[model samples]
Target: MPDAKPAPAQALSAPQKALLKLGLTRDIDLALHLPLRYEDETRLVRLSDARDGQTVQVEGTVTHQEITLRPRRQLLVTLDDGSDTCTLRFFSFYPSHQKALAVGARVRVRGEVRGGFMGRTMMHPAFHAAGGELPDALTPVYPTSAQLPQAYLRKVVASGLARADLSETIPPELLGSLQRVVHGTWTLRDALRYLHHPGPDVSLDALEDRSHPAWQRLKAEELLAQQLSQLTAKRERDALRAPVLRTAPGGLHEQLLAVLPFALTGAQRRVGEEIARDLARPVPMHRLLQGDVGSGKTVVAALAAAIAIDS
Candidate 1:
């Protein structure tokens, strides 16, 4: 049988382009847009049972909203779930915000509870309009700008994933090697899927800690790519010839060490020996010496310089 033809890429909608400020023009780009955080909407808490300082999610109707002045200009909103009433105060707000929280509109909000002048308050909560059935999975919250709505971005991402037709970017042999090393089982696509929309069965703790197998798989691939890049560059550099300097025994390096008032730490001595070895080698040295302040790196560098000069 003839192999099925590949699907053509879809152009981003005007709204989607605007929402994705990072210019995620390709399907792979959208796939790589990792969530900044996850919102678990499997269960909703009653406003009345919510405690101060706890971060919780609640569904409620906007009972009232009014612009107030005196203590300071602010927007006050009253939200009532069947269980209890809470205030949603906005010190920084605009007319559009007020319009969104019109009376009787149902919304889901997640925020840290703080005691306020108007009883229980959630000052600057992350919110979304609600009415449809609650999801049994974690909702990815992407990095967003003021102009971009979360819902709009979510829609764009969903569309991208559905139509992406993404081919495997990582070679199967390399993936297998990585899996053998880490005991991870997720594929690249699976990792992206789980990260963007984790099912209820997935451990929330692991997701938050970024220790989930899927996350680990993706992170490992990224690290492997970086390591491969470095190794390739090193190989290329090693191919080039460098001047070899064979220093005489009891050279200037030994003379400088004899005159120094302070003793060198073991670490300093080790680094000096390594640098001297590099200087003697025919290949150019590409070593990075990093140490905390007052670690005597300067002294080691000076010693290396003496070896270079004496040779």
Candidate 2:
């Protein structure tokens, strides 16, 4: 049976609906909406310690703001985090943005560092005025649309996680076997929870490298799902009857085999037999022969085609 459609979240705001462009209106959707990246907001980096090309977050007061038109039209603002000053540059900025960057206004900026005419710079960085308090754990950077409040989205997703009844996909026996092999103890829900709401102890390096145990578990689940999908498709395809194309035993089949310069390898011979069986079916034989450069796939294909001609 086809899977039941997920029920939509109750009383979604207009902006919330707009943000969910991927048709993710249900609690399950929220549960499955994995983060694109994560921000380690456990601590802020000093502007002086920030390295070029590395993504970093810094909090400081906006010390300067002015529009420059020498090379091209751009807005340049200076931020001082007490440790050092960094330039916040923008090529395309609005008057409101200029107003927001008023001198002495404290803001938090997160972006990749680059060397500019004015020393260390961050171009078009994600910035917002200083709020009440910063998060002490990993912060998720979700896929978003314009005008969507991130705080609101987080709240919605948190609610979903609280209310959604997540059905187990993997069998308990198989899960236990996999756990033994990997030495992992997380279930599907645990994996998602760890990813979505990682504690302070979770390493920033492991999360960034996608090599954490939680990430590995999720990756295994994804790979297994993909494999099962392909196998299911193959089984469905094999079930249909095909036209039998059997040739007489010692006729053209023997003639073609005799003319071949080299004898087929054991593996090739087995594959050839399998292909021969597939060709004898009433259903179309949709097969793919994949191997390295020196593998005898071409020769085996030629043999299979010769059999088709003989019939």
Q: Which numbered prediction scores highest in TM-score against the true structure?
A: 2
Candidate 2 residue pairs that clash: 241-283, 242-281, 242-282, 242-283, 243-281, 243-282
Model 2: per-residue Cα lDDT over 89-197, one tens digit each: 8999999888888998999888888876769988899888876676866888777677566676777778887777776688987888776655588787887887888
Scored against the true structure, residue 35 in model 2 reaches a CA lDDT of 71
Q: What tens-digit string does per-residue lDDT give for candidate 1 at 105-155? A: 888888887877768888888777987888978888997776667887787
Name the lDDT value of residue 308 in candidate 1: 81
TM-score of each: 0.72, 0.74
What's the C-alpha lDDT at position 49 in model 2? 89
Which regions of candidate 2 deviate over 4 angstroms? Answer: 1-30, 48-55, 112-120, 143-164, 234-238, 258-270, 277-287, 291-299, 306-311
What clash pairs does model 1 have?
A: none
Clashes of each: 0, 6
Error of 2 at 68 (Å): 2.0
Q: Assess candidate 2 and give its lDDT.
A: 0.82
